[model samples]
Target: MIKRLCFWLRADRLGPDIPITHLMLYFPALMRMICSKRFNGFGEGSEFRPGAYADNCSSITIGKNVAVRPGTMLFAEKGDGVPGRIIIEDDVLLGPGIHFYCPNHSYKDASRPIPEQGYFYKGDIVVRRGAWIGAKSVILSGVEIGEHAVVGAGSIVTKSVEPFTVVAGNPARLIKRLR
Candidate 1:
């Protein structure tokens, strides 16, 4: 009941979409209250900037001191009585326009449209402690971003990144290894 009320309050002002929906996050107190009430776990000192949104918040867990900038979206799928999960560890830095997708569409049937084929839950997405995700980066399902690793802006991560490494570009190839 409380969750529904919070959703209604957010939906009334945010309209259940990205970009515009993120505007409500500008109010720190309101955003904190809403997130605390909605998500499965929301740690202290985490900031959700304006223009950020999360789907299925109850399945998501956010750690302390994580900063999610504006225009970022975190989506977790709940399918077949199983809930998808996303875990953002402590001290993570997320830039603007970043997107995390914890589910993908099934396209096994050639004749049917992708959307009509239903969806697949790929598993949880874990952003390790102190990792930095650049602006506009897309982190796909089942991908674990290693601790202290850096994902370049506009990159598309399809696999788990190595710890203390820098990756960039589509498919997110490793660029440099940090000490």
Candidate 2:
């Protein structure tokens, strides 16, 4: 069991895997130790709970005092050799089942299979300071969620949200302004 645990503890191997999930739950400090170097920025006072999945963490920068709940997935796609950045600023609140996807698969060619075509990455996903993202929200590529903004549950954010605003629904229309 020690050997198996050691294998999963490697920097590149940590993710939504069950063993890692248990480790993060039972020994969060251990998870922090491994992730501190792997992530571009894993801030102080931040918590990545059990069942939170991330790929290309080297491209992810998380700020101070952020709370990422269970079932959240952070996929930071790399273009060329440089990874596409996913920046989550300080004091942010992410609810369960939130998914941040930075890569969009290309399907321009109708003749060829989509998988064979290739993939393209959008720009960085920036979640500014003090924002609250509700459960099951999907923040797509090239989107900027402004400071102190609130995203309602199950919202699919396609465009950049303005500061202090509340957005919801499939296309994530502006519901109200908080500021």
lDDT of all the models against the reference? 0.81, 0.84
Against the true structure, whose TM-score is highest?
2
Candidate 2 C-alpha lDDT tens digits along 78-126 = 4434467799999999989999988777899999998787777768899
The TM-score between candidate 1 and the true structure equals 0.85
Measured with C-alpha atoms, the lDDT of residue 65 in candidate 1 is 92
Where is model 1 more than 4 Å wrong at Cα? 1-27, 78-82
Candidate 2: the clashing residue pairs are none
Candidate 2, 32: how far from true, in Å? 2.4
How good is model 2 by TM-score? 0.89
lDDT of 1 by residue, 43-157 (tens): 8998766667777778888999987776788887645435688899999988899998887888999999987877787678999999999999999889999999999999999
The residue ranges of model 2 lying beyond 4 angstroms of the native Cα positions read 1-7, 11-13, 79-82
TM-scores of the candidates in the order shown: 0.85, 0.89
RMSD of each: 3.7, 2.3
